[model samples]
Target: MIEMSWPQVSARRLERAGLGAGRPATGTGLATVEGPAEGPVEGPVEGPVEDIVAAMCGAHAQVMSAAEASIGLRADGVTRAHVRAALWGEGRSLVKTHGPRGTVHLLPARDLPMWVSAMSSLPGAHTAAPKSIRMTAEQTDQVVAAIREVLAPAAMTIDELSEAVIAATGPWAGDLVMPAFQGWWPRWRMVMHVAAHRGAFVFGPVRGRKVTYTAAPELAPVTDGLGALVRRYLAAYGPATPDQFAQWAGGPVKWAAQAFSAEELEEVVFEGKRAWVLAGDTEVPADPPRGVRLLPYFDAYVVAGRPRELLYPGAAAARALNGGQAGNFPVLLVDGVVGGVWHQRRSGSKIDITVEPLGDLTAAQLRELDEQVDRVGEVMEGRPRLTIGPVTVGGHA
Candidate 1:
């Protein structure tokens, strides 16, 4: 086990490590995440691009909604539009649901069924309340039946579903499904439950209009296919422990452990930590491009698992990653390690980037920052106009 300093790593290093000119790198291997810049974004011959694209599509299979796909990709440096382009080649619907931990997340098309099953296992809170507010078993059954009926045919908007629940349970709507949390209505909790049980799939939630929903199919049958999906995740963002897998998969620790029990995975030491790596992943790029990238909130690099301390350090990781809220910050990646913070805004064709370095960087660091910013502009279809903040040159503001 060899320990490497976190300060020496940056996002660009991670991106270019062990990547090849062709797509075979992604086929069931430990391939680093890459975002091609200077070179034309083209794959090798013999249907490399299409095959990899198809594989990518397969990895996210069963995902009908775009909103869900967008968020997942956005976590990984791709934008909502990028996901749409990959899926429909034209804009279309995606799925979103109130996931575990009382938050909504974009479900990956391929992993939706497994995710649904894992989420369903979490015991609902509606049954444990006091007699004055507790939902009896019979009442719970009635609500479940009603929800099944309403969702059997097709999905419904939140408003429509709420109305249907209200209609089915009659006056009990205000008390039964919408229980009083110790006497006060827990609307958010109710919404999460309703969304979960219906097996409802979400499409693009048009800006201000109602979000469209549709009946989700029996995702259980297809869930067996997730073996490859899990492999892909581990390969793409790996060197992770089982506990990390459990957290990322939204499943129990036992299940997370089992997901990787299949052949093709090997535990390896990354920076001295016992981390799993895909057997197929071979190349670990040395002397990767040093660049600074301004990542969006909730970027995949930050949200992959619970190891901010591994990614950052003691006090800094604690403050920046508060219960996974690190996604909210505009992260600065210099040399693959999170170096500082950056703010970005677009004004017409010009994208303004303001970088605040946590410490003094070498000349090589500035060059790396330029490379990343250029990529961001290309992805966003804008011109790069960087404004280096004085914070990096001086002390913290």
Candidate 2:
């Protein structure tokens, strides 16, 4: 196996994630959308919003605004409006659904077939609900089928769909067994993510103030779909172990091990540990990545990258991460490693950003950080007011 330093890994990941100093290269396997820069806005917009989301695997949409910021940070002139258009406009280029780890994400509609194929089979999270509340595999299948049938003709709100499902599958599927915040939910809710992963339904256009579910659009499933996703994972965040991939995918380590062995990948000694990268992707950057980046909550890089010790090195481990898990707080990246934690509050057209650095930054990095702040503000659609001080806000759910 070849050897690689943490610096090489970070630099390679930065480039793959389109966060490096250089412009994204064409024909690099990522869905390349040629950026036709429109106005005096400086540089190329981050290709089309769909391409940006696809390249990053998917943008976390647990917090939709943060998800928008995550995508906006990558492009030069693109705004949150562009991201929204891709997700909700007539074109509907992006689909908001449960993605890797069963978390809400904005995935490219074009890639839904592949995503559904891979995620549908993963070992899902163990539910905290009591056994009586849980659906058996067969019963889960029943609920999924009910969802499919109810959603086929038209989109429906959760209430309407729940009634349809209960009527179709009997009261057992609708028993109030699962405990939520203050009320018990119907047992069928246990399989919502499962239903989504299997492409039974997807989030539809909002109806007034309520969210709706629509039957997933049909597409030919990709052959060896898991293999394709594995490659995409490594391409965006390579030189990682199967364990990391499993964590990111919210699957089993054994499953990831099986998937990796099936791939034609090359193993490397990454930071004295065995890790794998895509075949023939061993070339590293001559110089490490420079400059600073402010990544929003649940940014793909902070959540998907492996070996937490490296990405959140030293003091960052304590500041940026929430109980060893990344993405709870927005990360301040200095040279591709977590340098601090930041919080942003937008009031009308102005954004108040507070950054608490773990260590003193060099003058050059500070300058870069200033420009980065403006860029983030542009993406967030606010004028930024930078305050280098303590970030007292708690982590996001």
Candidate 3:
């Protein structure tokens, strides 16, 4: 019955999010049992792309590895198999769904048919471009067709894909090509995929390996059925306003609201503002472990929201949410908040992680950091080394 400020509400509201806890062990059943209100899971788990995206609504898959993204999502009940099934279900091709500032994302393997149906009805694709390039709908459609033909059989790098499209579409194609098409063509050559039912495209390799993209046949006919999943996104990340949904959705707010508002959602006031949550999502245990997590810059977990205040300090939040505006740097999490930053440089089988704690680390905390570095080493092919560096809280260098 009392009014609360955003900070106070944010602090209390996010306190229950359970984001900073490191990866939970398998069989822990953290998510299946009572854990956090955000869903279930103590730490993160590795899973396929689509499953993870389905559970989380939005995923940072474009930038992070399947393993890396899974590690983060395990903390919230999403798994690799789930992600995989979403992308390549039933051995059929999936469609790419583009929204939220025009970047294309992967949709569930089983959900493409309906997604494409709904999206095709919408007009005007948001072409993420610099001030110079302008393209008409007729031109855009032609390019899309040209690119599709080039990418239909096999995956090609962005350059290869672009060359093929240009050869067919003519020189003017380069001037009129939108950034999404430019970004997507290469991925299409690599392997076709769908982003939440919008369109079909491909993804390139990550960490020196070509990332696999696949489509699902079952999802092709259920355009109207995806309303359930849209509502799911709102509940898990909501209590947020519709405007926030639009931004996070990477699509028009009008469409996102229409998708989400079509269902039954529970409303709650979190951090002093109105919010909507899924009717059945349970709360996690209040007693969270004093855990630490290392998150990459532009990682989806933190970027899913419009503002970073829910999970980061004011200054740090601004940099993280720049929306591809700045370079991504790895971050250190002490408990659930960003307490410092870290960087690594590899030389001769050694990956040196230069740790810059916001404050001095306790001996125990230091040891924990060391263990985490070991995991990073595994990720970087078994060369684990550590370094101590001096840095301000928000400073990257």
Candidate 4:
């Protein structure tokens, strides 16, 4: 097994994530933001937003606003508008869809078919409902078919789709079974992500305040299967264990282990345990990632990197993480490890950013943190007011 230091692992992760020094600019055919923030600072840009999203596997979009900051701040000169355009533009090179953990994410549209195929075949990840309210296999199949047929002609709002689905699949499919925001959700609604993963439908543009679903393009054959998906995960966030992979994907550990066994991987030892990276992806930096980074809630880097203890050492383990969850709060990265948590509230043209560091930062680190603040403000489209004291906010604020 190859021996690797923890810092070396973090450095390689930073390099893959395009946060390391002298990162390359790889975003082609991407539009720049319209205007700079009031007090923008020039910084290094890695690439366009789409390419950045692709490299990071996908940007978590559970909080869409946070996702904009997560993707935009990765590159210099990128703004919130650029990320939104990539997602909603004519090219639609980037897409909003269900990804790992069945959560909303901004995935590269070009890669969506592969993701869909792989996720559709994943061992677990299906419509989750109580046994009393669960649909049988035949019922589930009927609901999926109804959704595909109903949305074939054009996009449909949730209400429209719901009515059409019940008409086609029978009223049993519409029985209110799951508790939602204000009322109960229909049984067919439980299979929404399942239908999405199976390529039956993809998220369409929002109409006014309602979300729409459209028929997905015909899917190509599943030539690569789960192996290809695993490789992509390894490339973006590898040198990891099957347990970590399962945790990230919200799949079973046994299934992840079997998948790893099928791949040709190289074992590496870090902190006295074994982990794996792709066969040839063993290079590590002589030094770990330097400089400060303020990652938004559910940032890909914060969620995917493993050895949680190392990434969230000391006070960060408590403050940045909520009950062992990695992405409950926006994290402050000091050389690729969690150092603090931050929160921002937009007030018209200006954004009030409060950073709560778990430890004292050097003057140089503090200055770097300021530059990070400026970059964040640009993507969020507001002038930043940095306060290096306590954030005093709740989880995901």
Candidate that would win on lDDT: 2
lDDT of 2 by residue, 215-321 (tens): 88887776566777887788778888899899999999999999999988999999998999878778888999776888999999899977899899988888778
True-structure RMSD for candidate 3: 6.8
lDDT of 4 by residue, 53-152 (tens): 8677789998988999988876777788888888787777788878888888888776677677667777645545567888777887898899889999
Which tens-of-lDDT digit does each residue in 81-200 have in candidate 3?
444444445542223345334445554444444445555444464545543554555556666677556666766655566677778877766543333533532222221122323354
Estimated TM-score per prediction?
0.64, 0.92, 0.67, 0.91
Using TM-score as the measure, name the better of candidate 2 and candidate 3. Answer: 2
* Candidate 1: regions farther than 4 A off: 1-13, 16-94, 97-103, 107-156, 169-173, 176-198, 217-220, 223-229, 258-265, 278-283, 286-289, 314-319, 323-325, 345-352, 381-385, 390-397
How close to the true structure is residue 154 of candidate 3, measured as C-alpha lDDT? 65
Q: Please report how far candidate 4 places residue 213 from its true position, in Å.
A: 1.6
Residue pairs clashing in model 2 are none
True lDDT of residue 334, candidate 4: 88
Q: Report, for every candidate in turn, its global Cα lDDT versus the true structure.
A: 0.48, 0.83, 0.48, 0.79
- The order of the candidates by lDDT, greatest first, is 2, 4, 3, 1
Question: How far in Å is the alpha carbon of 165 misplaced in model 4?
Answer: 1.2
Which order, best to worst by TM-score?
2, 4, 3, 1
